[model samples]
Target: MLELLGLSRVGEAVYRSMLANPRLDVGALAAETRLTERQVRTALDELADLALLSPVSGDGALRAVVSPEVGLAALLASAEEEAARKQRQIEQTRAAIAAIAAERSAGRSGNEIRRLDGVEAVRARMAELALTATRECMSMNAGAADRPDSRAASAPLNQQALERGVVIRAVCRESFRNDPETLAHAHWLVGLGGQMRTVPTLPMPMVIVDHRIAILPVNPHEAAEGAIEVDTPGVLAASCALFEHVWATGTPLGDAAAAGDDGCLPQERALLGIVADGHTDEHAARKLGVSLRTVRRMMSDLMERLSAQSRFQAGVNAAKRGWI
Candidate 1:
């Protein structure tokens, strides 16, 4: 119990012995604790440092323990004060860093920015931001450049941050769901507890962490050219607002292919939803995990069920019946 209060084993032994025998000296403590006199002196010095043991009088040979209640509470209070001071220092340092960045860009012309010169640098910046983001990280994938390796590299980051209770929201273009590979990446992200949504289109491949930093590719198709990191309040704030607006309009993936009041299975609803989202038959088939012929057969079945002559009419009829 005293060890929990930061007393070392020897110090605790010495203190306990001293408490039991209020007039015990260092030599008596050593004998009682089965410790050498030198070891007992060391323990006594430790206890004295912690204020658990104080000189009994002007004489240095004997000592007494302050009550555990008072001594331990004092130790805890000191620890808390130290922790609070460190926290304050950390906040101040963060403020200084922000101020420095702001000051550096204050007088620069044409929207101050820093160029992220290479793929490695961009990835490093992303890792840094993800590590620092305490509250949330929002992302958008507007391009179709999600290679297997890139997605794989992001797996651990997404998994760890999600486990850390970070609120992760990602938005991808509707067409991305049609690519089997991209859909696999989405599924991977979802498995990590990330909330993914789809929109008709996205602005670009970008990440906004904590709404304080925004990372964007210079060119959606040519990311190798470089990237940009935006920290200016106006730009960051606008980007944050835009993300929220888009998120509000995006359809959550699980519900993206969700069935309606028509009592359809999720797969059928996924097929209908994919079709309604403007994917071609081949793309829809790929997304639905079926063959082109199967997609055609399903569409024919849907058309027959709705009593429609054409595929478009079938969709219209389904909508009229509140199926899509």
Candidate 2:
């Protein structure tokens, strides 16, 4: 019965002692339970806090005692309350699980893809889908100015997605390095363990996920215009292939420091080779006869292209995206 009530052994002993001998002194209670006086006092305080005991006056003397009727009532009430709370929590959990199951079922149906228009609409859909993503996110973004509203729009939803254990992989253009806003955006993505990379060139803003969902801008200059969402295997495959081609030739963020001192556009393969040698930025820059500022600028550009918050994140992103 004590175990059923979730009472520890010591608590059970204290409770039993109180029940058997109401209004007993703390010292007597301790003796009965063979526990220390401090232990008895603590247990009594805990039981009283739980409303299992009541203060009473015995022959004009104040004493703590178990109330035969009230004690039973309090115990029963506590049990009922605990049961109700657990039931409500279980119901909520079940509802959430059911909702997820429904979404997965819908995703697998392979029906028509949903089309959304306007920047606001696209942001809204990305937020919604990002909230639901479980495994991974793949994106091809046109630097920051292309979607000024994306940060605030995608932040909350992206955070929620990360909490759900989704992995993100993003590809952007080399122009991202020059834009502070875009670099900050890349930082946010990297902070969430998402991968970012930059290419020398890009077609337009697009987002692809799990080889199933694709988002493409209808107009190259107008992201807010109607965008198409494609779920077809052929179209998704083609877009994914395009992403791979760019990724293959892009410079990794970490390798920027070692590529050259003169800040020459390091060949992608050569940059990787230098990075593999584990040389420091300063040493690599001196070897190539480039200034520290130039090295830093090149590194910054590399991180921007990779959408990395730090060199470490950039490396991780590049590896995951198969860029390096």
Candidate 3:
């Protein structure tokens, strides 16, 4: 296993032996493993160089395996730092190429529409644009809440943009609020000062930076395949319009509930309506696309608010408040 960290197989065997028998000397390690004394000594020196072993205090020939928690983590961190340095070099080279290509195409394509392949490349470009956004960032997430990882991957960049005072408004499918994981991400983004809303559905996943550039999936579903970025006035306007149309139909997650202000929210009111129509908790949860647990919790909250002992009384109180 240590070979995975660039240790030789012999070195790994010696390290394992030392870990198993901390007081093992070079001769004992060689006798315990399949190596000769000379090979064991060589492996010990190699392991020591990699910080995999520490010399014991009392005996010159005694060494112990460094605890993996410290030794392995340090090695991994060093590797990561080196990889990050190389990535910086690669980014610089890519920037130089992009600059030269842009100069060459300066007069050829007016308000050029660029196609980017792969999700990583597309996300990198989005991050690049976000770095320059001075106004606003608008996004439509289609069914983003369906995928648990979608929000986490972009949360840092989104938060950075928010910190830059860029207004971010995002709309996702209403079912997003039904799932705890999805709701958590939406609330997290809201906590970072980005506005989030939920709608029944959306046309596609898209992002418009400062209303100057819009990035869209070329095949919507297979976003990993590629994306098309639009910057021309006409196309950009149409994309922004699409987002606005969806936005108009969405309910902002943050401002949608005033818990104590009104007795019920729009969704909670719908829940009451479902209950009024004589639906069971399971039926209501199915209708709302939420789990049965969530439906029960909502009912419990409603019952407490109305000072009711039963669902029937909760409905009666809701009716009195015109919530149903």
Candidate 4:
């Protein structure tokens, strides 16, 4: 009980002895405590001054007395008051610490801005921001570059956020053709209660949350060259608006393609299908079990045959040509 009151070992022993043996003479108390008479008397005087003890007899025998039950109750009450005071002090200290941290982060600018360069750096930043997200998160995927890495990093963070009751929304290229990996990732996000949509073409690869944080690729071609983190409200809001615009015209990736028995050139359809899934030269080559050079040559021939300027345009041209 004395320990709960924040008393030292000696103080606790003295107090407990007084409580156990009320109205004991100084010498008897000393004997019970295994302390010298002088030491016991000194402790008793201190306790009395603290209003924990009093004189119970009129005789001059130095028979120190413990206070009444009401006094003991008051002492307990004082301890409670002290505990409450300390708790309040602790809370104030924590608030100060949080304020300092916020100020430090808010003051960062220019060189203080973390410049993540390279694929590893970009992945790390995404993971960091995803983990720190509190209320909501938004994402837009342009070509699905680095998607595998992004999904891997987001999975655990998404799970944690769901457990913490955060909302997540993701927008991807509408052309996704239900590739095995992309489909699995879409299902995972949807199962976690995340909202998702597909757009014909994302304005950019970016992420924004709560109008306070944003991440966008530094170089569209070299996705591994990292990205810039934006904290400015105006910039983040603009990015969010762009995402919303695209999302409004987007379709759900899962509904992009349907089973068909109508006759069509299977190779042309398959090529278009893979392109829609965001496969680059190397990716399409591996998926088709063909050499990189062969895939490149075939892609050139397909583009020329369709009279298109780019791979994406070629895919559209193929559809327009009634080949897929």
- Estimate TM-scores for all models: 0.52, 0.50, 0.47, 0.48
Q: Give the TM-score of candidate 1.
A: 0.52
Worst 10 residues of 4 by lDDT: 257-266
lDDT of 4 by residue, 1-324 (tens): 555543445555676787787656777877888888888767766666667666655776543445446656677888899989998996687467557656766778632345678878777667666655668888886654336766677788788767657788887654443356876778787887887876434446888865577888887556677888877767776888887786776555455433245333333456567786778878665444345786687778878878899988988887776766
Is candidate 2 or 4 superior in TM-score? 2
lDDT of 2 by residue, 1-324 (tens): 555554567877888887788757778888999999999877877776666666675674324666547765667778889999998996687468658856775866563566787877887777756755667788777643335665777777777667767877777666566667767777776777777776544666678766678888788666657688888888888988987776676655424423433333433323333444676777444433345675567667767877898767766665665556
Please report the candidate that would top lDDT against the real structure: 3
Question: Ten residues in a row with the worst lDDT in model 2?
Answer: 254-263
Give the candidates in order of TM-score, highest first.
1, 2, 4, 3
lDDT of 2 at 276: 42
Provide C-alpha RMSD values for all models, in order. Answer: 8.3, 12.8, 9.5, 13.3
- Please identify model 2 stretches exceeding 4 Å from their true place: 1-113, 145-148, 253-263, 266-324
Candidate 3 per-residue lDDT over residues 48-163, each given as its tens digit:
99998887677465667897788888988888888899989966875676576566547566577889999788878877776556699998876534565556667777776788
Candidate 1 C-alpha lDDT tens digits along 49-143: 89887665575556678887898789988878888999899778756755765675466754557889989899877876665566899998765
**lDDT, candidates in the order shown:** 0.76, 0.67, 0.79, 0.68
lDDT of 3 at 301: 90
Candidate 4 Cα outliers beyond 4 Å, as residue runs: 1-104, 109-114, 145-149, 257-324
